[model samples]
Target chain A: MSTRLPTFGNVGLAETLQNRRLLAGIVVFVVLALYPAMTLNAYHTRLLTWIMCFAIAAMGFNIVLGYTGLLSFGHAAFFGTGMYTVVLVMGRVGITDLVAVMVIAMVVSGLVGAIIGVLTVKTHEIYFALLTLALAQLLYILAVRDIGGLTRGTDGIGVTRPDFFGIPISELPAQIYLLGFYYHVVLVALAATIVLLWFVLRSPFGLTLKMIRENETRAEMTGVPVLRYRVYSMILSAMVVGLGGALYAVLIGHITPEYLDWTMSGEIVFMALLGGIGTFFGPVVGAGGFILLQELALSYTEYWHFTMGLVLFIVVLTLRENGIWGGAKTLVERLNDRRGEQ
Target chain B: MSSEPILKTENVRKDFGSIVAVDGVSVEFYDDEIVGIIGPNGAGKTTFTNLISGALPLTDGTIIFDGEDISGLQKYKRVRRGLVRSFQIPQIYDEMTVFENMQASVLSRKQENNRLFTPTHRDSASVSETERLLELFNLEAHADDHTEHLPHGVRKVLDVAMSFALEPEIMILDEPTSGVGSREKNAVMETITEAAVEQQIGLIFIEHDMELIRDYSDRIVALHEGRVLADDDVAAVMNSEEVNQFILEGGV
Candidate 1:
């Protein structure tokens, strides 16, 4: 409309800058890979491994929460469902292969996710969030009290490491566990899932999800099927979280009723907030930060909840609109701007 | 031009409780024509356009587009059939760059938005088409800038460019220059008119500004109380006694 509009620079330098940012991301991943070796402590290795599992769940949650603009407080339903599926299949179906168990878990979780998504997609914003939370709590109740025979009720079920293509992991030398072999397996899954998600985020489907996030009406008018895509997103997100959960079951060797609780969903949300909401790999950073803070707080006192609450309050107050990665990104951008001026 | 009608509504009516918003209004539009819809407040200019664009359902009537009845089509289905509409408030993605904004439309129109493995930026065709529209709308400069960071006028132009990227046969703009600066109103209308003529796409726009309506539209459809008061060439509509007294003179 205004020809006098200032001509902003195009993608020439911006593309190069994006590539640099990607390179920085890869460097971070490399460092994360080398972390267990550097720390050389089993506790730290196990802690980091658990952090990876949480990060994976957070990453999956980001599809709905960050990209699609849906705040889901029920992702733990999918996470716990995935782990429970693994345990059930191994116990009832006599599935001994870890991959087969994970595959089944992912499928079962996806079906559950689709059912929940169908019921919830019609509502939006706070209502959608509330519905997801309610449905998740329904699953939690089923796991904890209603389905005691199948789920072991409030006590939960113990998980045994299954064979990997005929190789019995549970019978593996005890030294390997001490050497963090399971930790490396978790890391590999985390890395592979991250790469897959990165591709998805770069895809046209991802762009459409972001468009829905930015403006739902505009997206609908532009020929984007808002409801259908959202359902797909929910299923995909659930699958990713389910996979993470399956891996988590393998890592922890146990599944508890609390795994499906609403608090677990809140923890996932906190992890996303700890990292940048929409930024790639922000959830991973957030999970690590969240876990470290929780561990640190628990070490000092039993009031870890209060300590965690205080830390979250500080973050929300100081950071306001962004998580840790977003804050760091802003700082870097500011530095770059000053450098350009010079 | 073949003179074949690109879009038509027959006895299209919409009622809200006891009040009839669009009372059996029928109009025919052809390709390569710019039709301006002007009316006083509560005249149903927007309501009629909403029905045509599938934003709202018709209480009773039939909408024929390209010789097919599309009265029951959903908004997105209407868009897929090349009947697109731009919002009066310019609904562009605030967080996305201008390039991404246009690319979303381009991708959706191509039915390539479901590809989960291929990166959106890798669609060179959509990218090139988006760039062409941006250049046509004089928005190439802000293609990489986020829509929120751009000026309101630039964002308006980007909104139109994104619609154009959908390759619509007919575009209904609620207000082409409603929020545009007074000085740049001519630029906005001129750019839109020139692009519509160049692409030979049918255009219908709602406006309250008399001068802009008179200057850019080949024909004008004036509405009053949810009914067509005048439908003729711009000069004829401008000279109509009813239109003059009701709309132009602000005499309800």
Candidate 2:
């Protein structure tokens, strides 16, 4: 084999740029980490935290729909499973440890994902999407009916903030004093999720997922077990979404059947698309933009849904379906091209 | 050339409802040979290759690859066993660059498709192999070009190159020169056949061009109405009365 690198050139420059991007990412994370300290408004900090949670979920949704080319209309199933697992483990099992609760939630959601993947991965196109919707709706109904009184029905249930490493975050004084502390915890989780997903998207497994997305038949002909990989994608995607849901449960400290509803799934999909479905950091950008937009719309009018919908329509049309981050990325590339020419 | 056949199909049949695409036609393919499959448009050539490649399930026969019955194996499993095939229309990832496309096949060949955390660009072995294939196919100039904008001939070459990247013992090319320009057809064939010979890969290609078939194939398998009419040396099959009457003259 030839020892020379492939003749694409700019290898050294690309590596330098990659390192710069990494440094930039770390700098951004540090700024986000210190934001709560800089801002006195707890509400804004909490909003940012909520955005991070949704970002996590949207990132997970991207793994399957964006990367693997499987559109799922029922991701709320895993997200809701995560939410309910956190609430139930804390309430029924009396687990006061946030770490333990999050772990349990992820495991439960992952199991639910695996089961749903087995049932749905065989179906293609609209059938696969519809099957997921059907399954998620089934879960929603179970939660709504409060089957065996486990979900507490439509009335929902409130969860007190659990202890984090014996920090007593549940106490009122601690809750006020350690509000930034909780925000920091969420920031750390979001950062970790980003790092993990970055590694995944760059990995061989991620490349195969993209192969499946680009051409399933070609991928199969090239020695990829398509069905098995789809299932694996489903499981991993669900676990990530589940982790997001667990964080969301902790952030909101309340659980309801609405969390399990199809609307919630739709919102997750919207978040992914708004940020550019397949691009790295797109989902997070989408989530952050979505939450901020909702917050802004809700403040101005009761017809916020109408306002948000109109904005989304305009954004979609203007971005040409590349999402906000994708659009921004294209702009940057264009600028760099001009600079190179000059 | 070899005493033992590397791939054998025993009475393999494919049916689409009541229509039999491929009849119970048994054939043996040995390593170190170039076999051309020639038939009219609707003949079972592509369907038969599909059966052997495990793209389509056999209706009533068995496919033995490397001395193992691969009748029930998945398409990818057949590929893993080095029975690879290129598509008739050049199936490729339009969104990915040519280099990435070749890298995908190399990754799959190395069984590294499941490496969840190692970035594909960081995979030195697969990357080197991808570069090698690109160089072998003279696709280095277009390595970074997205396949969507590639010429039809280049796309066809990329498809064949991807199959080659799997390091297959036997490679099937379904109308490899179809849709390629007349001027580029010979060049495409020359590149493919030369590479196959260099790598010692048995080639089974389907073609409509009689001259190309006669020039490249060591043997020819003539099919009409899903049945093998003649399976003999290229000269014998080309000269056979049935092949000329049904396939060359009337069939074409």
Candidate 3:
């Protein structure tokens, strides 16, 4: 018998392909980094900052929704819970550090995600989506009704911007750079999150989750602990979204009952779908498109819902089933094929 | 070969609400053996295998693997204990490459699937094992191709190859060539049986193809209406009068 370990010839080729893909991802993020410097407009900066927050949350949602094929309509519950956790921690403990608040939110939302994931991950497809929606609604009602005097009922609460780490706003070099500084912080956080999620999604655990999405029964028989992975994905997804929520709290400087609503959950799902349901970067694109569309529509008329619905309808009808990113990917592939032929 | 059974099921029964799918089917599978289970559509061959593999809850019976009572164990836990099975229809990750499908199975087997930070392709042990299985199954050329795009025969081969990557001590295959082309069926069976034999892995497979079964399996168990109609050496089981009337005569 030969002592050499056997392998397919294409393993090296696959690695090279992955490396190119990684390079392409870095290129995309670097372009994103230059956005603030190019625009320099405070309004655009704030909009992009909010997009960064949504993108972080949406990317986390992609692990469960895109890779794992679990359609969750209750992601906003985690986001809202994260915001609430941060708000409560800031109010009660008087700790105003953004990093500390983000950590607390992640832990709290992660626990909530675990509980919900354990209960609901067993159900497939529509039922899974509905169960998650119900769970989110349960949290929403608790927040709206103020169950234990924690949320201050429907009136909600307001917050002011806290110091960035230990450096106060006055300690900043210039007044114009203060708000932009927060945007930069969000951008940095978003970039780090993308890199982190990229590594995770490329890992074996991510592959297993994708397998579960493709065929749950097959995945189970193949020794993938389906429910466990689902919960883990949910926890990881929730923590990431929770971090986004913490960032959002820092950005908006307020907390409201609407943050915990089922509509918020639906909005996250919309962001994912409007982008592309399956692709990793699609949700972030969807987040940007969604926020922009919402802003543009509301400015034109009060029927922003109507405009958003029309756009969604058009995209679903015209684009590839995978969504915007999938469509773009297909377009690029077709172009590449054409070029190769020449 | 050792007479000590690797996997044994006693009075295994499965009831689908009103009907008994698998009725009191008791069997022992030993190492270095391929047991062919031949039965008609509703003869409960699949259910019997499913019950043994913990795919379905047992209505009434005990499944003992390696001298341990494993009836309560989940399907994945059974797999961890080196009891793995393949599906009738090829089950694979459609979006992933053929190599990735094999790698995922190897990772799951090694219990390194949860290693979030560790890249799967970078795992030297899994990479080597996956490539070996791919090369063994003659799927090296299509290693980088997405599984969804592979031909039916290749997909089936990949599915079985992935099962082998799990390092199953006792692999139960349900119709290894149910949807495969006529000409390619023999090649698929030959590859699988040869690999199992070389690895010293016990195999119990359900098949309608009598010729392939006779050619591959050392022992034959014939089922009729959720009961084992015949169990003997291949020649004896094939020559049995009852098996001839109920199963073979059914024109499967």
C-alpha lDDT of all candidate models, in order: 0.87, 0.89, 0.86
lDDT of 2 by residue, B143-165 (tens): 88999999889999999999999
Identify the superior model by TM-score, candidate 1 or candidate 3.
1
Q: Which candidate ranks first by DockQ, i.e. highest?
A: 2
Supply candidate 3's per-residue lDDT for B184: 89
| Candidate 1 segments whose C-alpha is farther than 4 A from its true place | A1-40, A335-342
| Best of the two (1, 3) by DockQ | 3
Q: State the lDDT of candidate 2 residue by residue for A90-129, as single tens digits.
A: 8899997989888898889889999999999789889998
Candidate 1 local lDDT, B1-252, one digit each (tens): 447799999999999999999999999998788999999999999999999988888999999999999999988999999999998988999989988898898899998878887776666666677777788888878878889988889888888888888889999999889889999999999898888888878999999888898888989999999999999999899999998998999943
Clashing pairs in 3: none
Q: Candidate 1 residues A206-291, lDDT tens each? A: 99999999999999999988999899999999998998898899888888989899999999999888787868878888899999
The native-contact fraction of candidate 3 is 0.71
Cα lDDT tens digits, model 3, A1-342, are 122333435567556557887678768767767766776666887888899899899888877888888889889888998889888988878887767777888999999999999999779889988999999999988988999988887888876556656878635654244345777788888888988888788788888888888888878888888889989999999999888888898778778888888888878888888898778788888999999999999999999999999988888788744778888889999999999999
Provide the lDDT at B205 for model 3: 92
Per-prediction TM-score to the true structure, in the order listed: 0.93, 0.95, 0.93
What's model 3's TM-score? Answer: 0.93
Worst 10 residues of 1 chain A by lDDT: A1-10
DockQ of model 2 vs. true complex: 0.61
DockQ (Cα-based) per candidate? 0.49, 0.61, 0.49
- Report the interface RMSD that candidate 2 achieves against the true structure, in angstroms: 3.8
